[model samples]
Target chain A: MEITAIITALCLVLGSLLGITGGIGVYRLPDFFTRLHACGITDSACAFLILSGLMFQTGTSLETVKLLFILIFLLITSPTSTHALAKAALNSGETPLMEQQQTQQKREER
Target chain B: MLEAIYGASCLAILAVMGLALLRAVLGPSAFDRLMAVNMFGTKTVLLISVFGFLTGRPDFLDIALIYALVNFLGTIAVLRFFEGRKTPACYDEPAEEQKE
Candidate 1:
């Protein structure tokens, strides 16, 4: 039990660090698409770590089952939303920084 | 020991939440704002779950689960709404406006 508690604490701390990193990336990254990558880090990995940590604390119980459900739901939905957001951004003509640079280079060559 | 850890983690998550909010406020385009909002919602879900555990009420996991569902749907719905717009009004205006 003591070991499990220690592991749970570790997971929570690690997840917190990852989440903070993602948040900072979102805040400081140069472009919208780059920020999307940062958001994906928190949406997938950080959520997984934190929820799994909570599951470890719960052990075999209804609460564990609920946490598992939340974990799975987040895993599935987060990527979908990220994808949808990216697609919508593209459809709305938001060009990424890299692509803009490439086009500028092509025009200069021309 | 576990409780103290949980409390500390909760505070860290809250700080992250504030960072995400700052991004949303300072975001240059609509998509940037939307992405920040989505990230904010994700952190909110984590915050609720951790707080629930800190208070010894695991039942609050259900609320967290429901919140995850709503956040997903809300993001997608907003994306679809933006997709329907003919002109990219939100993106082009802000970048140019900020330049001046």
Candidate 2:
């Protein structure tokens, strides 16, 4: 029980740190695509860490099963939604910052 | 000790949520707003689960699960809504439009 508590605490702290980092990245990143990358990747990792920590606290029980389910669902959907958002943004003529810079460089070379 | 850890984690999660909300409000483009909303939803799930454990009512995990489902669907649906439009307004650059 002592070991489990330590592990749970470690996971929770690490997850919270990651979550805070991701949130800042999303806010401070320069481009939509970059922000999407930060949001999509960290969202899953943070949730996984936090949920698994909670699972550790619960040990083997129905709550653990539910946490597992939530984890799986988030893992699947977070990326999917991010992909859909990226595709939608691209389809709607939203250009990435890098692409815009590249085009400007090309125009300058011309 | 565990309770104190839970409380600290909760405060951190709330801080993250506030950052996400700031992004959502200050996002220069529609996509940024959408991304912020997605992040916010993800944090909400973590918050719900941690708070559930903190309070000794693990049953709130059910609400977290359902929230995760709805958030995904809502994000996708909103993305689809934006897909049909030609170009969403970008607040950062008003003089340029995507021609294409």
Candidates' DockQ values?
Answer: 0.80, 0.78
What RMSD does model 2 have? 3.2
**Span of ten consecutive residues with least summed lDDT in model 2 chain B:** B91-100
Candidate closest to the true structure, highest lDDT: 2
Docking class of 1: high
- After superposition, the stretches of candidate 2 with alpha carbons farther than 4 Å from their true spots are B90-100
The alpha-carbon lDDT assigned to residue A56 of candidate 1 equals 88
Question: On residues B12-88, what C-alpha lDDT tens digit does candidate 1 reach at each position?
Answer: 88888888889878767888888888888888889999999999988888789898888877787777677668765
Q: Per-residue CA lDDT of candidate 2, range A1-110, in tens? A: 49999999999999999988888888788888988898888899999899888888887899999999999999988999989999888887888999999999999999
The lDDT values for all models are 0.86, 0.86
Worst 10 residues of 1 chain B by lDDT: B86-95
